[model samples]
Target chain A: MFNAIVSADTLRATLDSVSVLVDECKIHLTDEGIEIRAVDPANVGMVDLRLDATAFESYETDGGIIGVNLSRLEEFAGMADAGQLIQLELDEETRKLHVQIDGLEGTLALIDPDSIRQEPDLPDLDLPARVVLEGKDIDRAVTAADMVSDHIALGVETDEEAFYVDAEGDTDDVHFELGRDDLIDLVAGDAHSLFSLDYLKDMNKAIPKDAEIEMELGEEFPVKMHFDIAEGDGTVTYMLAPRIQSD
Target chain B: MFNAIVSADTLRATLDSVSVLVDECKIHLTDEGIEIRAVDPANVGMVDLRLDATAFESYETDGGIIGVNLSRLEEFAGMADAGQLIQLELDEETRKLHVQIDGLEGTLALIDPDSIRQEPDLPDLDLPARVVLEGKDIDRAVTAADMVSDHIALGVETDEEAFYVDAEGDTDDVHFELGRDDLIDLVAGDAHSLFSLDYLKDMNKAIPKDAEIEMELGEEFPVKMHFDIAEGDGTVTYMLAPRIQSD
Candidate 1:
């Protein structure tokens, strides 16, 4: 048994953060909090989300798993404004999730938990470089790179003492760089990786401009971004496998 | 010779007003101002637009006709933000309209005046009812009607002493009414007519919320909406043929 009250905004941010990488996920609701870990079907990206009890207006659970179609949730949640209060309750007998707003309630059929893919095991990596900055900065760089190329390279150019996002098109190239003082903080190391701009562009939608983002990277290795949502009540982590650059 | 500098907002609003109904138009640049009148290919709607010389930052034009594709102009004008200075220059020798903004100058080819459709003759209408209100009020009513039906009936409810926009769907009916106190003014008469929501919805995009809209209607007659644009330097008139109500 699990039921809770939360803002439409918090729910939207939570689902949107994971729906970008996976279509469905099994939400684990426990007495302490809630957690969801899922990976993209192509094995290219993974999203891990966790929210403590404090995140919900009122929360109670007897420890259970609820499988849901995130794509559908995105649409249902879209109907409510950001500030509206949303109530969620499980209809165990009918295998449905009841979503209630001010004067309306929509019953959504829950997917069988067995149908969803199993969660991926978290990888252990000694990423050499770490950078902290506003999510909007990376969002801006991603938008600029998309105008020029399909892929962008994130790297710390040691010699230049600056981090850069670079993209090259057939006839044009774009590059945005930030020095030490420009970033919130930097644990500089010899690290660089290229990634698909398409993925980054979709990921940016879930990240608000004012939110802080911490990034970890290594030479020819995957990139990881960590951020908080629900007013710091929940944490969302994104890990994307790097695309190899062919010379 | 026709050359003028106008605010991007005025140009966008002017082109958007007529382009909603007609694709190609012949702009007449007379010493008084610029004007265009066109009807949609289906002959269901007519848009008449006029802007005085005062609307332009700088104006100079010896009476001349310039054929243009309003759809293409919409795209070019969209490149500049509202309030930006947009310079329009015509090169008679090249048959080109040069639009200059900031560091960019886009040259759009002009359609041959002979190839465009002939100007439409203004129809004489004796609509019996007149309603004056904010353009936004009609915009809101149209949007609500779109949710329930494709055609909406507009008329005065003499018994109720109110102007009503009514639409009936398969299982739902929506009606927005404005009493005399709620409207700017209303000249009530024995009038009722149905109009396609599709045409009204498209026309609403060009009508600013702050502009005053005057509407005329009669039993089984065409509906005419009039409003000013370009800071009162221009007036855009829209006449939509009525859709027969199939009771």
Candidate 2:
């Protein structure tokens, strides 16, 4: 059994991050906090999220995992205004979750955890470069790149000590660079990778403009992006596979 | 040759109102001001707009008419920031309009004024009831009625001295009323009419929330709505035919 009272913004942020990678996710409820990890059906992207028990106003749990439809839960959370409190109670007997926001109440049938695809173990990668900057800068770069091409190249220029985003189309090209002076932190190592803009665009929706995001990159390898949410009480990490560039 | 400089907000507001009725319109430019009158293809609705010379930062003309695509001009105006000035120069020799905003400039080929549909003379109707209220109030009432039915009934109850909007669906019904005290002004007369919600919704897009809209209503007659635009330098009037109630 589990019951928790959390702010509407926190719940909505969690759902927005997870739903980008998968429609259904297993939410693990423990005494310490909530854990969620899911991979997209294409196996090209993965998202891992954690919310500390401190993030909630009231938290209680024995220990259990419940599979839920993320889209449905997101829709329910949308009905509540920002800063509003949301009450969630899980009924193990009937395998249903009771959600209440203000005077509106709804009972959602829980999916069987066993029926969901088993979560895959994330592979450890020794990426060479690390860059940190405000989320809005990266979002703006992604938007500019999308106007030129379907895929974007992200790289750290060690000589210039800058991170750059580049996209080349049949008739147009876009380039954006942020130097050490503009970023919060930078390792300035040799790292470059090309990834699909579609995945990044979806993930960017959940990233707050003011939040600082740390990203790891490697030559011809996947990219890792992590950021804090729920007022630093929660963390979300996204990983996306890179597309092989043709000479 | 003619040239004018007008604020983006004023130009956008003009295009928004005229575009709702027709995609192409003939703009009559004279020494005094500019005038546009167009009717939808179905002839069920009409929009008449006027902007005095005072609305523009600079106005010069020798009496002429130019046909333009409202949607294209609206799109161009959207690129400018609010309050930014836009310059329009007509080249009678080439029959092309030169539009300049900030650093961006484009030449739009003008349509032959004689080839476009001729303007219709608005019929004069002696409506019995007149009501003046904030644009947002009517917009809210229309939105609420839209959720329940395809047509809405608008009437003035002389006994209550109130204006009422009512809609009935198969399983739901909505009714909204504004007493004389709530409106800017009201003339309670024997007036009632039913109108298609589709037309009203499109017309509401151009109505500013703070603007005072004066409406005239008559029993089983078309409704006339007029409001000020461009800081009282311009005015827009819309007339919509009534739908006969099946009852």
The number of the candidate with the highest lDDT is: 2
Q: lDDT of model 2 at residue B125?
A: 90
Error of 1 at B41 (Å): 0.8
How much is A153 displaced in model 2, in angstroms?
Answer: 0.8
- What does candidate 2's lDDT look like per residue over A1-247, in tens digits? 8999999999999899999878899999988899998888888889889999999999999999999998888888888999799999998899999999999998998899998877866678989999999998877777766655899999999999989887776544556788899899999788989999999998888888999999999998999999998999999999999998987
True contacts kept of 2: 0.00
DockQ in order = 0.04, 0.04
Where is model 1 chain B poorest over a 10-residue stretch in terms of lDDT? B167-176
| Residue clash pairs of candidate 2 | none
Docking class of 1: incorrect
Query: Which sections of candidate 2 miss by over 4 Å?
Result: B1-247
Off by over 4 Å in 1: A1-247
